[model samples]
Target: MTRRTVRIAMNGVTGRMGYRQHLVRSILAIREQGGLALGGGEVLWPEPVLVGRREHALREIAERHGLTEVATDLDAVLADDSIDIYFDAQVTSAREEALKKAVAAGKHIYTEKPTATDLAGALDLARLATSAGIKHGVVQDKLFLPGLLKLKRLIDGGFFGEILSVRGEFGYWVFEGDWQEAQRPSWNYRSEDGGGIVVDMFPHWEYVLHELFGRVTTVSAHVSTHVPRRWDEQGKPYDATADDSAYGIFQLDGGAVAQINSSWSVRVNRDELVEFQVDGTHGSAVAGLRNCRVQHRSATPKPVWNPDLPVTESFRDQWQQVPDNAEFDNGFKAQWELFLRHIALDEPYHWDLLAGARGVQLAELGLRSHAEGRRLDVPELSL
Candidate 1:
């Protein structure tokens, strides 16, 4: 098959996910394979050109990657007739506006999640992309993860018949930026800049629910800013406007319910970092960020819950390990390749703007539920 090279204009090329994951990891994966296979012709490979804020930083990135073309002006790249796609890894606050502009310029868009801080804005962006007849996608990378994929397979196979509910325990303590220069950027703490676990992570939960259980119809949640203040790399204290943690209940279409506890404050003590436990009438499965285990009804034991009595083991001992299939790379990279393939092969990648909006809507609904102390209906934003 003849390879059709797709030129990609990568915005925010110097940011953390940009230089390391989006550029180095994603583009490198495509390049390493020479080209990705698709239904029609090959997606060829990405020709990623860098665009960012600082010229010096951009130059360093270009030199490090052995690329020469760099642009400080986004408009110039958007205006360039040669570029076929616009890739955005910019700060959350900047993502919506930049993507709107890119869509207007007639370029396909592949951007990071939390597409917008507000539901209305996100919906409008979705409409704009649809009207323009452009390919659009968001980073729902967790779905592509090996562990999560295995869990999805089990659910599809009806390994968990009549799934009762799922409990997700996710998080790890992050270092203060001042002393250790935190791994995540400092801007993530500011609400004005589109920071919050409810907004950032509910998209992940939404997809997981949509995949493992069913679509989420409503959400009731409470959010908190556990650490109200944090110091930046420069040793200057900044008020944290976004919630550092969120506790929410997802009401699925069926009677099934899911409880999600997402936080940045918790310390990891178990063998698995992020664990999702699903219990059903037939069996139960426990999946972590790195592994998954399942136990059938045959192994179920009769036990009585007694507060005074120290109960024996509740879980079965004959739990089987779920085999890992595909080699999982960085989550961001997995989604990147999928998006490019979708564009190249006309493959169905429904995890686009509308799918992304479900997540934003969840956050917006979660915020309203938190503020009003009530359950909020999750509105549908069409693709």
Candidate 2:
């Protein structure tokens, strides 16, 4: 078998999601598995060149991971002719400029979304990448999760039988820096730093709804900063200018309504930190990060509401678990493998920069819907 190496310039490895999911779980895990087999006796391997503003951090990660290449200069990294891909997991504010440079350098682009801080910027990246004829993709990792995958299976198999609505609850309490160090970066609470639950999570919701159910046609939202003041990384108090919680109602193309609540202030009571329940005429299913449970119309229980009587029905116990018929991989890794295949083998990939732009558009409209106190239509984006 012929082995082909694709050199990737990976930026923002110093951050949590970049380091943990993209670098370690996805790229490194693929390497450990002896690279990805592209049929016809060809194997595609990843060679990562770590890029960041901090030379010390880059060098530290390189050494720890037994990697050789580390560069603080992005321009120099981009100039390397051997580099096949440029991947970014940086903050929203910084992503557009970096991705633009990568496109100029003729590198295949793969990055975390919003794609940019706003819809215009996201569309610009899409246009640039499309013009450059580069194989570009966004990190829509949730689509590959075991739970969502199972849910997709159900959708494809007609288990839903005319889906009616979707209800999603996603959140967990993030520690304030004073008593305990904040679980998320301090920038997440500051609007000036491009921090907010709306911008952060609405993108995920957009793709999930568009892919699994239907394209979101309209959105109504109410956003708030439930925790106005929080301590920073240094244990200093700062006013949180961004909304920490957001309640959104999305109208899908097929007359299905999706209501999702995203919050950093709420405590988790569900089986997973995030879960979505989809109801249909025939059945209903609830899916989380790793598990999915369904209650068909035949098995669904009916209960009478009475204040005078104690509840006797075990509602949770009635749902049947979705079996994993095949081995499941880490969601991030699975998407990474598909992206790699798209780059090396010319496999069709749908989640391009345009899809990412759609996500950004949803977020922008969601925030606008909250501010204007009305539902907004989601126009189809074209580049």
Best by TM-score: 2
Off by over 4 Å in 2: none
Sliding window of 10 residues with minimal summed lDDT for model 1? 310-319
lDDT for each residue of candidate 2 in 1-383, tens digit (9 for 90 to 100)? 89999999999999999999999999999999999999999999999999999999999999999999999899999998999999999988899999999999999999998899999999999999999999999999999999999999999999989999999999999987888889999999999988999999999999999999999999999999999999997889999999999999999998999999999999999999999999999999999999999999998877888899987767899999999988999999999999999999899999999999999999999999999999999999898
- Choose the strongest candidate by lDDT: 2
lDDT of 1: 0.84
Model 1 Cα shift for residue 149 (angstroms):
0.6
Would you estimate the TM-scores of all the predictions?
Answer: 0.94, 0.99
Error of 1 at 314 (Å): 9.4
CA shift of 313, model 2, Å: 2.8
Against the reference, the lDDT scores of all candidates come to 0.84, 0.95
Look at candidate 2 and tell me the lDDT of residue 227. Answer: 94
